[model samples]
Target: MVGAPVPALRGKPITHRIPSYKLYFEYCPHGDLHDVIKAQVDEREVPVPRVRSPGGHMRVQKVRRADGRLVPRTNRTSNVPFHEGFVWRMFEALAKCAVAMERANVLHGDLCPTNILLGEHDPDRFAIWPTPKLSDFGSSRVIDAMVASRFTPPETMQMNFVPPELGVMRGDWEVDGLKVSHRTNVWQIGLVITCMMRLEFYLPETDWRTGPSSIHPNDELHFHDPNQRELHPHSFQHANCNYSPNLLALVRQCMRYDPARRPSPRALLQRIQARIPGSCGGMDTYTGDRNGSIPWNKTEKLRGLKKDNEWPLGDDAEVVDVF
Candidate 1:
């Protein structure tokens, strides 16, 4: 994997409209960030995925010169096939990120593939991909809304990564406080893992009737009660797939109908670490460093980012308009 320098990182302050809370957040760096970009983004109460609130603004190298400037520029992940081992690594990184956010009383409500970025990427081939960094905190919440209906309903929820229980909430049932919780995050994580493991498990937007993706709506309409096992769809049809029994079981537990049954982030991390030895290692290990390497925090000095001065946008870095 080719290493690239992420010079700085920044977070902008944002205000929550519904609950009215001010938040300043940080991004999990996939590679070493030389300087912590201290620049504050423009203050706006508007809502937009990936760009809103404390998630901040970043100036990325729009293109790279492997040899010359003629080559096309590249970035990020989605619909990308991942090996089981690579997926496990990604899971570990995400679990660490999730634990950090939870400690700060934050919930990454949207944990879909679209929101995940591969730290180091090779557009040509996806062999042995880099550590995954969770991004797009637009839907994140300070308070746990899993059980409560503070957010919108599941049918109206357009994202593909939401847990089954979330997909079925409706009407007064939608307003119930117990609808979502930490377990909801657990379920979303499980779904992402499942998708990463078996791309076949990913539902084609056109053909939603088949496979595990279909289980949610089917379960919602026919198997409302968990006890009613007859019409309820089973998630584990992947016996033919290569995943070990232990990993498969973990995914099932996360996607459980009862949010109470899901594992806490700490517990989930332990489970993942147990399955994969030294899963939660430092930056060097994450960047595929085999030798025993010190943690990034101990060695790397963090420099504060100045909003205007630190990183002037490069000529090649054109801002893409976001709707």
Candidate 2:
């Protein structure tokens, strides 16, 4: 399977006497997938008339209400859903990443929109950004089917992004017989895509009454209902944004509550490749050069970069000439 590129470590780690370490990574200018998904749901405020204030500064026009209270005029806005093609591209990119992880026998416990970062857009590769790197490996671990059956994810995991199997567990927080495998990654990839399609954060079913209550101490955590139809992509699909049946079916397959029923990462990648038109050549192909070609560098025409040493770091740190 053609594995997606991950963010490269720019330099070796910098160790300090205080037992702290610093690492530099490739800069992703467009931010993460969460930012992109948020942009879709976020309303772009319409420009409103401004009035000169007593201080001679332009300010939003205010109107007096019936109660004699002045309020700024509310700006009109509209939700713009992501394009169907863009969603498909994002799905394909993430699917490739899943395949890579599966091959390495690693399980990214936290696979969410925030963890999937976006690099600069490269038109020569894809209509949208060519590279969407899977990042933040702090929660990742080597996969072990036996250990996973008895494993219970920590409460810190992003509750909304976890698969139904992981989200809806026994009151004791035990996974029971459920195995966390590549299917888990598939579920998260589907969820991220679903969020992109719906243009909002996907909130799974939760019972607030039973959660962290004096009466139900065991039910302190939120549990999703696996049987809910809302878990399916079709339920949240927008009529205005008509995605292909194949894409929807693939996403649905990934979100299957039964981990054993979901497609493997390689299988998922193959399915995604089938939907994409033309020969699967270049970076998308499994046989393609993994490192020789630099697609992210193609962004030179798209934007200018700050001189290497001039790049900003935290107040406590300064740039070092590692080269």
Candidate 3:
């Protein structure tokens, strides 16, 4: 709602409704990535293990494999140890998104946690609705380099979750017809999972105890030092809860680094359905309030698919400089 105009403002302020006519194709109160997830989780959630590369974890802007090779980081829970049957429902839902995407041929070039919306609401608080329309498209293609520069100054297309072939053209893609592919969306989807689940990929370090800034969008997409607030799903809580790992992974798969490496939307659909063992029913709903807020666990950080305290658990004082 930060950017949306007030309903009563048409009379007092400048006119608008004309440009926003496209809102129908873009928004759905109960159909989004989040609803697809809420349709899966319950009170009892299976705990999962966090997975990261050798150097703690890779940054979104820059990802490397566990073996030190620069590679795509897609397949959200595939790399995680706790990805088995216990509580990987969220990852499956994310996989479903990809499956659903294939039916539409609309690639989610740039995927992240925010693009993932929640659809289930306790009717006691609001209502249970099912709106599984993938919310953000063209978002990846519309990155404001000036705004992006403030975070990591994005250069060299990401390869963490995409196909290796795309990596071959990572450098200077502007001149090449080498556009971000479907797999690219899949890669970003995986990252979205890592961030939504309690386990996350990276943590931003700006001495929150001293900096004039608060959490930035890139914070959910970056990680540099061992000493930083983690991006756990619990960190993004608002009401009394946050996203479950099963739900978190749904977003992560969308955030995969490589485009080709991503699961086709159809494949993602199969994966998510297998996890939930249900149909894409209207058991969930998520309509952003006019006020920029929602009900969930309240935390000030956005992490990947990892635990919070375990990140800096080691006593090795080694400082790896990402910059």
Candidate number of the best TM-score: 2
TM-score of each: 0.53, 0.67, 0.35
TM-score of 2: 0.67
- lDDT of the structure predicted as candidate 1: 0.48
lDDT (C-alpha) at residue 190 in model 2: 83
Cα lDDT tens digits for candidate 2, 57-136: 98877778999999877665444555455566678788888888988988887888888777655545553334678889
Error of 1 at 224 (Å): 2.2
Question: Which is better, 1 or 2, measured by lDDT?
Answer: 2
Q: Name the TM-score of candidate 3.
A: 0.35
Ranking by TM-score: 2, 1, 3
lDDT sort, best first: 2, 1, 3
Give the clash count for each candidate.
Answer: 12, 0, 86
Q: By summed lDDT, which 10 consecutive residues of candidate 1 come out lowest?
A: 33-42
Local distance difference test values of all predictions, in order:
0.48, 0.62, 0.37
